[model samples]
Structure formats: structure tokens, C-alpha cells
Target: MSRTVSFTQMKDGTREEYELLRDLEKPFLRLTADRVLEELRRQEHVTLEGYKVTRLEHGLQSATRAERDGADIDWVVAALLHDIGDGLAPQNHDRMSAEVIRPFVRWDVAWVVEHHGIFQMLYYAHHYGWDRNARDRFRDHPCFDSCAAFCERWDQASFDPDYDSLPLSHFEPMVREVFGRPAYAPEVIREGHVSPLGA
Candidate 1:
């Protein structure tokens, strides 16, 4: 068995107890990649809105397209996970998925994931009485074109059941590698000219 802190309240925790808790966090933190992959697998069974493919298939298709288009690992992983939250938070899945990958990916990749939902509206929002051009609100934002390109090139077109999508297993290694990097690494922040947390 492992050691554990006994403090009932955070304010009452001693330095030794806090140290032990911090040590205990290491293994759990290391498992973050595994947990994320498991969640993606869980999405394999999630179907929505009469789409021709399951959420997992759609994610794989998107990632496949990104990889084939020569997108970097971060962008490919972002494509793979851009809709991971759909099964749990359909109303705001984009935000939820964005938050999951935000800490580990580049600023532009996270920005695309965060706004892809609105960009996707360019396809069919008008069919539901919503403005299909709702994405226009962000037209002046620096990442706007990138997000639009993501939706147009990979996301919206991923629903094809016959598309030759790569298997989830094919992306597992990339997912692990991407997640293994330090969250908000100095290089990513400096290259993107963004804050540590990409805020």
C-alpha cells in the first residue's frame, strides 16, 4: 500500500502531508494519456444526430485527414480529439474538448479545437434556423482562418462512412507522445508568442 495524507482540511495539512500528496500525484498524472485514450475509445459507441459514423470514427477520420495533409503532431492529435466531449457535453463539446487538449497542444491547435464548433456551423446551422455564418463573428481574430480551415478541411467532411480513415490504434502512439510532452512547454509558448497557458 502507498502512504496517504490524513488531513481532513487543506488548511490543516502539514508540510509533510502535502509533500506526500504531491508524491502520490505522480502516478495519476502519468496516467493522463491512458485516461484520454480510454475516453476516446468510449466514444466509439456514441452516435448522434443520425450521423453515418460513430463519434470515434468521425474523430479518426478527421485525424487521418490532418495527418495526410501533413499537419504536425499537435494538429493531428487536436483533430483526433476535437469532438471527444460530444458524448458528454453535446451543447458545448467544442469548449470541453478544447480544454482537455489545451494544456498539451500548441496555441493554434487549441484555438482551432475551441472554435471548430462555431466554424462547423458554416455547414448546416442555417438548416436549423441558426445563422450558418455564425463563425463570421470571429473573422477578425488571428486564429479565425485556421479554425475555419480545420472545420472545412477535416471536421465537416469526416462523417463519410466510406472514407478510408485510419484506425484509433494508428493514432494511439501519437496521442501518447503528444500528451507526454510537458503542458505549456516553454518552446510552444515562445513559438506561438503566447502566455504560458495560452490565455
Candidate 2:
């Protein structure tokens, strides 16, 4: 059997125990892409009750759109994962999905993914007696326009079963490349930079 930490509480862990854990965590950290892929694959059957396409198809379509539009890796990966949290957090899936890609993608990409849900309200919120322009509250934020464009160009328009979305295999390498980066790397996050979503 492999060695295990002996601490009953995290604070009581000795340096050696913590070191051992850090060593053991390397493989788990490297396997994050696999776990993300697994979660995405699970969405194949986790359809929203009324959508014509499954969640996986919607994501594949969005990513395909981004790729065909000549978006960079960060944008493409963010597009693919922007709705990944739908299965577990339908009401706040935007934020959940953002968190999934935040560590690997740029700040602007993460911001757009996080807020696309609000921006998307422009499409159907008014029919529900809600303010369609609710997203206007963030109009002055740096990523506001990008978020709006993301909803308009990718997220909201991706539900068609007839769309020729690329298969998950096409994006698997991009997913692995992004997730394979060192978590929270400053160069990867670019915390305050707002790169354009366009090609």
C-alpha cells in the first residue's frame, strides 16, 4: 500500500506529511484534464428538459464556432467550457463554469464566461417579465462588451442540432494543453489584461 498522511487535522500536519502530500498530488494535478473531459462526457446524457440539443453538443458547437472564427486557444477553451457547470449548478452555471477554466484561461475570458448568463438575458428575459437589459449594470466593466459578444456569437446561438460542431476529440488536445499549464500561473491568468476576443 502507498503511504498516507497521519494528521487528524490539516493544521497538525508535519512538514514531512505535507511534503508527501505535495509529492503525491502531482499526478492528480496533471490528471485534471482527464477529469474535466470525464465531466464533459457525462453531459452527453444530462440534457436540459427542453433544449433540442444535449449540453455536450451545445458546448461542442460553441467551441467549433470559436475555433472557426480564429480565436486563440484561451478563447476556444473558454467557449467550450463556458456552460460546463450546467449539470450541477443550473441556476449559477456561468460562475461555476468560469471557475473551472479560470485557473488556465485569461482573466477576460474567465470574466466573459462568468457573466454570459446575465448577458444572455437579452434574448428571453423580457418574455418572463424580467429586465432584458439587466446586464447593462456591468456596461462599464472592461469585459462587458466581450461578454455580450460571447453570448451573441457563441453561447446563445449554439443550440441547433443541425449545426456541424466538431467532435469532442478535435478539442481534446486543446483542453489538455490548457489544463496542463501550471495552475494559477501569472503568465497564464494575465489577471488584468483584456485581450480582444476577435482573431
Candidate 3:
């Protein structure tokens, strides 16, 4: 049988109850990669900008490009997940996707996911009368160029219908491996760390 906490409210819980909850967390953490992959798979039903590919395919293409370019596992995974939020939070998908991966990948990878929307604006924002140069506001930020390059090279250009993208199964192991790392390693949190592609 499973253990249960007797308290109905957090404030009423005893330390023993809290410890039980903590113990449960370990198994839940191990399932994070599976949940994330399922969420990405759900993007197959979502389409954007009249693109010829589903959002899932777009994600696969982005990851495939990064992998072929010899990016590390972190970069490849980040690329794979960068658009996972389009179905739930289109208006602020970047922030949502970034938060989802923040705990698993390097800080710069999270930053790129967080800010790719803004950097991507440099492409079509002008058509909507928004400032195409809006991303310039962060010109001096350390990760600005990296974020811009991500949008320019991968995120912005991944809408093709003909690009041969890898199967999601090919990336399942990589996802599990990246998410299996410690959420906040001290070395990765330091300043000036770049992704494998140096972008």
C-alpha cells in the first residue's frame, strides 16, 4: 500500500508528512522527460503561420539541424523544446518553453528559449508594424547574440515541408539524458558559458 499524509492543509502537515511527499518527488522527477515528450507530441495538432509542417515536425527539424551541426545534447534538446509552448501559450510561448527546460539545461540554453520570440521578431514584426529592431533593446546582454543566432539559424527558418527531420524516437534518449542532469550545477550557472555551437 502507498503512504498518505493525514493533513488536509500544508500548514497542518507534520514533518513526517512532508518527508513522505519529498520521497514521492523522486519518482515524479524521473518521469519528467516522458511528460515533456508527450507534451511535444501533442504539438502535432497545432499549426502556425500557414506553415506546411506541424509544430511537432518544426521542433524535430530544429533539433535535427542542431544535431547535424554537431551541437551538444543540451543545445539539441533545447532546440527540440523551444516551441513546445505554442499550443498552450501562443502569446508568451517563449517564456513558457524556457521555464519548462530551465531546470534541466544550461542557463544560456534557457535564456535562448526564453528570448527567441523577441529575436525572431526581427524577421516578421515589420510586416505587422511592430518594431523589427525591438530585439535591439537587449543588444548588450551577454546572451543576446546567441539568442539572435538561434532565431536566425534554426527557429525562424524551420518551417519547410521538405526538410528530412529525425524521428522523435531518435531524440527520446537524448531528452532523458539531458533532463537527468542536476537542475542547477554550479559550473553551468557561471557567466560566459556558450552552447556547443558557440551561439
Give the alpha-carbon lDDT of every model. 0.85, 0.91, 0.86
Q: How would you encode candidate 1's per-residue C-alpha lDDT over 129-166 as one tens digit per residue?
A: 99999889999887887887788888899999999999
lDDT by residue (tens digit), candidate 2, 48-99: 6899999899999999998888889999999999999888899999999999
Summed backbone clashes in each candidate are 0, 0, 0
lDDT: worst 10-residue window of model 2? 1-10
lDDT of 3: 0.86
* Cand. 1 TM to true fold: 0.91
- Model 3: per-residue lDDT, tens digit, 32-92? 8989999888887777667799999999999988888788887899899998888889999
Worst 10 residues of 3 by lDDT: 190-199
Give the Cα error of residue 145 in candidate 1, in Å: 0.4
Per-model C-alpha RMSD: 3.8, 1.4, 1.9
Ordered by TM-score, highest first, the candidates read 2, 3, 1
Better of 1 and 2 by TM-score: 2
Candidate 2, residue 134: lDDT: 97
